[model samples]
Target: MNEVMDYKFVSKETTVNEMIRGKMRNIKVITIGVLEESTGIVYPHPISEFIKRQYEFYGKSL
Candidate 1:
């Protein structure tokens, strides 16, 4: 089976305390996605490992 999982990374220019202090700053955010494959409709932890392995395999190919 084929599936996809979404992951996100966020960066804040100011700390929460700074924000509370009324400091204005720009916030940056980044997002990434990883496709997960499974043998069945439900994805188990083992299947997630498989996806990681696939990535490692292709990464080494480079």
Candidate 2:
């Protein structure tokens, strides 16, 4: 089983407040695709860690 990771460094409340204040800010949501070799299928996956990292990065910049 894949272990779930907790994003301790990022603050969701702060991110939301920043977005609310930056009325014209553009927010891009990205989802990574996971490929299953056995079935030769690609599935869209949304990883919290990956997305939160972006939020954390942007939050620090702000």
Candidate 3:
């Protein structure tokens, strides 16, 4: 059987200089990083447009 878990988020206030900022530039690069450290299945990208087109036709979601 599967188990469900609940999580709580704790946050604090801080200044911009105290925080670090960066960007991956691409999600593919991040995924490659994860693969380097772990073992898992990964799907090839450039997925079909059918799902996207359907979503747009009906309504786009967040």
Clashes of each: 0, 0, 0
lDDT of 3 at 54: 60
Which residue segments of model 3 deviate by more than 4 Å? 1-38, 44-48
Q: lDDT of all predictions, in order shown? A: 0.33, 0.44, 0.28
Query: What lDDT, from 0 to 1, does candidate 2 have?
Result: 0.44
What's the lDDT for candidate 1? 0.33
Could you give candidate 3's per-residue lDDT for residues 1-62 as a string of tens digits? 22212222222222222221563332111111111113233332232234434664576511
Per-residue lDDT of 5-35 in model 2, one digit per residue for the tens?
Answer: 2112222212222254647555544334555
TM-score versus the correct structure, for each prediction: 0.21, 0.28, 0.22
lDDT of 2 at 50: 60
RMSD of each: 13.8, 10.6, 13.7
Ranking by TM-score: 2, 3, 1
lDDT accuracy of residue 5 in candidate 2:
26
Q: Whose lDDT is higher: candidate 1's or candidate 3's?
A: 1
**Candidate 2 residue spans exceeding 4 A from truth:** 1-31, 48-62
